[model samples]
Target: MNARTADAPAANPTSAPAGTLLHELSSSPIAESLRRELLKRWPSTPDRVREISRYALLAPGKTLRPLLLVASADAVGGSYDGVLPAAMAVEYLHVATLIHDDVIDDDELRRGQRSVHAHYGMADAIVTGDFLILTMFTSLAECVERGVPAAAVLEAVRVLAEAGADVCRGQTKEAELTSDPSSPIADYETVISLKTGALFRGVCRAGAILGGAGPDHTEAVTRFAEHLGLAFQMYDDLLPYLWEPGTTGKPNTSDAGNLRPTFPVLLGYESAGRGDRERFTEALSGRIPAAEAYERLRELLESTGALHRARARAETEAALAREQLAGLPSSEGVGLLAAVAELSINRDR
Candidate 1:
């Protein structure tokens, strides 16, 4: 669906549209409760760290990771309540990474506002990120205390740790390529997959595992999230070139000005624009079950056409992900899960 539609309640606010997945899933009671729990977990000791962390973590976001957890639980016939702690853990970890990412990138803004480092200074921001990471571990410990098996908690932590490493590697790779105009598309994909896809995969897999889904189902969910996350990063990269600062509610063109090898830069402006259109077309080609929603999504992405080829690759990956879920049991949550994949492919911000 279009970004606005995706963000808004369906045509009927009282009842969700048929196949209008993620609308309520993201706003589910379990997800909301988990968000509250996470907010409580932020370090409250020193006023400075607490303030910086709160500002950074409380920014407006879709809270997609927790939604994935709750949705996966429902898909497996499990109670979303059972996985609330784990879901919060995932979100805490994500915020931790974002905090560190801002510091590393020297980003001046986030979510249309000054970044923590910019507003609070780099030292405080770095400590804030560290506190969040530690809090994530504590949250995971709470999950275990709540009767989730030690194995499940451990596995989730492993995945999160690996994802963190992948993010670091991706950042390093991106740094290396920033000044090099001839970077290969494959390299860019690798970076995006490692940096962005890794955490998305971890979130889905952790959700499935906590939901008690079998290994195969967890893998399927992970694959779906991975592809969707890559598409998210690609689309995010394109935003800098296509949107004005206030229009996107965030600063634009940092990548372009920094000489980063974004899709538009790599493919050349015209080719990249066309590629985005083609990808949007492919995403809406009815090759997947969520094609109708994908059409709405296509309309959103086609406005930019700045990362079409990367988007096309994401479409292929998303199609494969849908195929992977064919063998899983059907549930209302599955539709929401699929919708999340579609949304990721076409999200505007």
Candidate 2:
């Protein structure tokens, strides 16, 4: 979803149609209650970590992951009250990853504010990230303390840990690919699956497990979230190229400037004519100005229908996510969950 600052100008009226799923979700009592509980549950800590945590955690968060977890629980006829701990713990894990991600990407801002590392320092950012991860465990333990079944909490923890490991593995793979233009498309897809899809699948499964869903139902939700997550990151990869500066809360051409092998980039190279392929590779090599390179690559993508191909693939994944929702019973929560899946691609930033 697009990030908007309090004072940022309204949409350009020229960008792609922005979806209302996030707006609709934010207005729901389910998401509203989750936001209130999150704010209340935030920990008091040393001034530095508290400030950093507050800035990152309480930013204009969509709370999509937490919402998904709670809804998944409700979809299976579980109690939302019982699933709150899982939902909060998932937020802890997600926010911690965001902190670490900005540090790794050397990004200067987040959600329209200075990044933790930029506002604080690398050391403070690292420590604050670790503190948030520790809180994830606290939130998980709270589930059992709150009278959720011990066995269910244990299963959820196992899945969360596995997903966390996959996240790290995916980050490592991405770092390895940063300089190698010849890196196969396999590497990019694997990275997206591990880095993005892993957490999405894990949280859904964790919620289902909390709801006492059987293995079959849990598996269905897990698969559904996997495709949804991949669609999310793929759209995220496209946003830097598609969005105007400030629309996405970061430099629009940073991805191209950094020469990363994003989905569109790979497709553009494969589909372009021979001469355009050479220019496309040159633009991606960072040997020229990022702005010029960004425009050139975008042109190549459009000419070769690479943009259309990539968008179609993302739409397909999103549709697959919707298909998986059929096993879930009809409810307001289910309806919201379906809308979120649609939001994965229809977003403007």
Candidate 3:
């Protein structure tokens, strides 16, 4: 491990009580309500499939995407009942991505437990992910039954479809970049935007649409969520170095183990001088022991100031996200979303 930067600001930003609020938002009445609805609406047959799918879906999580969807609706004066199904739809899609991501990365842990693939084998995990994808659309269809207009449901479907495809594209690009670990920062930005930002924009846009927002407000929240997504991923990349497996709920070295070119890796390589640059290459290419490589890379990331630079960029993106919130109407929902933008940069996990 590297020494903590004495000059760095406290890890948790003062602008938002991110960790506490995440717990509050996840366990709030709305979240519990979603849980009940999920169990109620879940398919009843094929006991094994239902059981396996529930393992991941019902697992404890921040449920950030669902909260974002619900908050966007509330910001526009929309009711929870009308948007409940869309909330489910987004969570379904989110969980599927997590499961598939773990499979691809060969990660064993998720949310502090054995990952779906590690627990159930690859075949079951793959099919369970597909089942969740099908359920995302089925949940969308339920929105119509909940009194959302058919056209609105259709539009939400279209938005989520595009977002899902973009995530695939982003993952593909990320895999390609692993071969060229020193890829420029701009290319990394493109990948995160497609992978993470697209879904954030889609859910917020769909929530705005279903909540009766006009063109301008929809655009504003979409922009807000996109920036928030960018900052979220930046902070996420910092987590492995900043926190441990117990705190992050996943192996800290998973990214390095898989040879994934994460933000910190790229930034450090760019900023390092001759000696540190050569060491960074050794770590990335596995020329050294796993434990040594992990520690050396962390030290290099800190010494080269890559960690500081990444924190600054995350703060900038969070600020940009908050700026877009001004374009939205004032409400408690907007406040929650604004806090979320702060949380994007401030969170520890």
**Per-prediction RMSD in angstroms?**
9.5, 5.6, 6.7
Ranking by TM-score: 3, 2, 1
lDDT of each: 0.65, 0.78, 0.81
lDDT of 1 at 155: 85
Q: Pick by lDDT: which candidate is best? A: 3
- The sequence of per-residue lDDT tens digits that candidate 1 reaches over residues 241-311 is 45577645455645533445665445532343556544534333344444343333435435545356655
lDDT of 2 at 154: 94
Candidate 2, 183-284: lDDT as tens digits: 677788899999998999888889888877887878878888999988888888788767776778877777777777788777777766778878877887
Q: Indicate the worst ten consecutive residues by lDDT in candidate 1.
A: 1-10
True lDDT of residue 264, candidate 3? 79
* Residue 209 displacement in candidate 1 (angstroms): 1.5
TM per model? Answer: 0.78, 0.90, 0.91
Task: Report the lDDT of model 3 for residue 47.
Answer: 83
Best by TM-score: 3
